[model samples]
Target: MKAVRLEEIEQLFLREVERPVPGPDDLLVRVEASGICGTDRHLLHGEFPSTPPVTLGHEFSGIVEAVGSAVLGFRPGMRVTGDPNIVCGHCVHCHAGRINLCQNLRAIGIHRDGALADYVIVPQKQAHELPLSLKPDYGAFCEPLACCLHGIDVAGIKAGSSVVVLGGGVIGLLTVQLARLAGATRVVLVTRQASKRRLAEEIGATASFDPTAGDAAAGIAGPDGLLPGGADVVIECAGVAETMEEMPRLARPGGTLVVLGVMAKGEKIQIEPFDILFRELRILGSFINPFVHRRAADLIISGAIKVEPLITRRVSLEEVPEVIRNPARPGEVKVLFMPSA
Candidate 1:
């Protein structure tokens, strides 16, 4: 088996490695497709804390090739996508139904061998079978979509609510769709990329804007205001300082600002304390998707959220390093690595 491995920071190597054998309670998957994430970029550049010498893929789906004796409710040849966040069931967070915060959590690809190879093993508890009608590319979105689902849940976005998604990346795009489904009458997507902006409009955004050139939020609530104050909810998916700087302000008084992006280690974004009290704004930092992998799988299967537009590239396992090295790779919104290709 060939796996994309990270031996050190800012370095990724494609190397041949021995195949993994499923242990008791584990299911071995012959990976078909895997999604390269922003986290993968962080892991590659040593921005995200991760154990060294780990296979770099977590958003994935594949056919079950083997199952441990202790595993049940599944068999070989089943198509599946699983939750990568392995949490300690005994932890306080887990008992409190917030397992995403489990202190002893270990994720596939980040903390263990992942699906960036011919074979990947995960606990049977984590695997969710995909419908036969679902394609591999769609399954690869289960993980990220699950995270977005969790964010929407935290946001409490309601039908006919006004929403702003501050980023047009895969995550931001997904949040836009989810907000619409949640009944947001006006969905505004803020992104600098024209291509992504156009795509967001095509998908479901009531409008898309390039925040750098013109005032997107301003256009919504300027003197000739489309919205008087601001959106009811603001989901910040841009892991940059500027968006972080503006999240609280763009949110309407008594509204919510959900932080969906992973901030760099030790990075700080300034926000006025008085604004929270006077505006009575609700600020929340969402972590990983908690217990929503099943919901994500079902949502994808039901076609509740269209993921086809978000997939921008299809590459093989061998092509990953070069794709990661080039930031300007054309149409590289969400790159899916087909390990079996």
Candidate 2:
């Protein structure tokens, strides 16, 4: 089997490896589609914690080629999406139903061999069934969409609420759609990319802003701006220093600010604590998908959250190492690797 291995920090390659076998409660999925994520780049640079000498794809879906003897309610022909984050059920957080914050956490792609190869093993608990009639590429989006759903849950969006999404990447775009579905009437997407801004508007954003054109704060929240008094909720999805610094300023007094982005470890950003104190703002940091994988799968399967537009490119596994070695291409939203291609 061919897998994209992160041999070590700053060392990645497409290597031939032995195929994996399923455990008693695991499913051996033949990799169909896997999406390249920003975290993959972060892992490559050692900016994010990951176990090296492992396959590097977490957002993926595939056909079940084989199933363990202990598995039930699933067969070898089922199409499924794998939840990469596996938690220790005995952890304090898990006992409290906060599995994402499990004290002992091991994630596929990050901590174990993942779906970047010809075959990857998924425990029965983490695999969600998808209709065989669904598009293979779309299934790859379930993991990321699940994470975005968690962010939306944390943001607590309501009917007629206003939202400002900072970033036009896949996460940001997905957030925009979820905000609208949550009944937010005013959704503004802020990004420097003109193409992404246009796409955001077309998808669900009531309006879009380019930070490079003028003062983003004033343009979005200033007098006569889109949201004259700031948005009811501001979600930072860029995972960059500039957006992280500007997140609080985009929220109205007493409104909420949710950080859905993943900044590199040890990175520093300047934020005003006094401003948060004065506004009495609600701030939150949303981690990976905790309990929202099923909902994300349902949304995608129902065609409610449009993902076809978010897919920018589809490449073979051979092209994945280079894609992760560098930054995303201009205006690229989501790129998937077709393992069988």
Candidate 3:
């Protein structure tokens, strides 16, 4: 089996490795499609915590090549997506139903061998079924969509509510669609990329904004601006310092601000605490998919959320290392690795 291994920080390579076998409650998944995420880059640079000498693909889906004896509902031929994050059930957070915040958390790609190879082992509890009839590439999106769904759950979007998504990447685009589905009538997408802005509007954004053109704050919340008095909810998905600073300003007084972006560890950004205090704003941070993976799978299987447009291109497993080594290409939403390509 060929796997892309993060040997250590700043050291990544594609090498041949022995195939893995499933344990009593695990499934051996033959890698089909895996999405390259920004976190992969962060992990390569040691910006995010991860166990090195491991495969680094968390967003993936594949056909079950084999199943453990203890596995119940799944068979060898089933198509499934893995919830990479594994939690210790006895942890305080997990016992309280907050698995995402588990004190002893181990993620599939980050902590162990993942789906970036010919075979990866998934605990039966982490496997979510996907329809065989669905597009193979789309299944990989279930992981990201699950995380976005968690953000939507945190934002508490309502009918006729206004939302501002502060990035045009896959997460932002997915968040835009979910906001609309959550009944937000005025969904605004802000990004510097012209193409992503257009795509956001096509998908669900009622309008789009170019933050580089002019004062983004004034243009979006000015008296004659799109939202006029700011939006009911502002979700920061860019994960950049600039966008993080602009998030609170984009939300109306007494409105909500949800941070779904993953900023680099030890990074610093300037924000005004007085504004949040004066406006009585509600701010929250949304982590990974807690209990939303099943719903994400359902949405993808039912075609409720459009993912075909978010896929930029596909590459072979041989190309995975270089793709992770370099920065993402301009306007590239999602670049997937087809293991069998």
Candidate 4:
């Protein structure tokens, strides 16, 4: 089997490795499609904490090539999306139903061999069934959509609400659609990329903004700006220092700010605590998909969330290392690796 392995920090290569055999409670999925995430780049550059000498693809879905004896309700030939995050059920957070906060968290691609290969093992608990009829490339989006779903869940978007999405990447674009589905009447996407800005509006954003053109905070929240008095909810999905620093200012007094972006570890950004205190704003840090993977799968399967537009390109596993080594191409949203290609 060929697997894209991160031998160590700043080292990544597609190496031939022995195929993995599934454990009693696991499923051996033949990798079909896996999305290259920003976290993959983070892992490569040692910006994020990840156990090296492991395969590096977390957002993936594939066909079940084989199943463990203990696996139930699933069989060979089933199409499924894997929830890469594994939690210890006995952890305090897990007991409290906060599994994403589990103290002993081990994630596929980050800590274990993942779907960036010919085969990857998925615990039965982490596999979600997808219709065989679903597009193979679309299945790869389930993981990212799941993470976005968690962000939407915590944002508390309501009917007639207004939302400002910072960044026009896949996460931000997905968040825009979810916000609209959650009943936000007005959704504004903030990004400098003209192409992504155009795509955002076409998808669901009521409007879009170019931060490089003028003052983003004032342009979105100024008395004469789009939202006028700021948005009901502001989500920072750019995962950049500039967006992180400007996130709070885009929200109205007493509104919410959800940090759904994955910034590198040890990254710092200046923020004003006084504004949050004075406005009594609600600020939340949404981690990985906790209990929303199923909903994300359903949304994707049902075509409730449009993912086809978010896919920028599809590459082979051989091209993955180079793709991850460089920055995402201009206006690129999501790139998937077709293992069988």
Cα-based lDDT for every prediction: 0.87, 0.94, 0.93, 0.94
Worst 10 residues of 3 by lDDT: 111-120
Q: Residues 220-268, candidate 1: write the lDDT tens digits.
A: 6555545568889999997888898888767788999999987787788
- Put down candidate 2 lDDT per residue, 23-78, tens digits, no spaces: 99999999899999999999999999988888999999999999999999889899
Single out the weakest 10-residue window by summed lDDT for candidate 2.
Answer: 332-341
lDDT of 3 by residue, 1-341 (tens): 89999999999999899899899999999988999999999999999999888998999899999988899999998999999999999989999999999999999889998877778899999999998999889999999999999999999999999999999999999999999999999999999999999999989999999998898889999898999999999999989999999988888999999999999999999988899999999999999999999999999999999999999999998999999999988999999999656
lDDT (10s digit) by residue, model 4, range 1-341: 99999999999999999999998999999988999999999999999989999999999999998998898999999999999999999989999999999999999999999888888999999999999899998999999999999999999999999999998999999999999999999999999999999999989999999999999889989999999989999999999999998988888999999999989999899988899999999999999999999999999999999999998989998999999999999999999999655
In candidate 3, which residue ranges exceed 4 Å CA deviation? none
User: How do the predictions measure up, each by TM-score?
Assistant: 0.97, 0.99, 0.99, 0.99
Cα displacement (angstroms), candidate 4, residue 73, comes to: 1.0
Question: Which scores greater on TM-score, model 1 or model 2?
Answer: 2
**Relative to the unseen true structure, what is the C-alpha lDDT of residue 186 in candidate 2, on a scale of 0 to 100?**
97
Model 2: colliding residue pairs: none
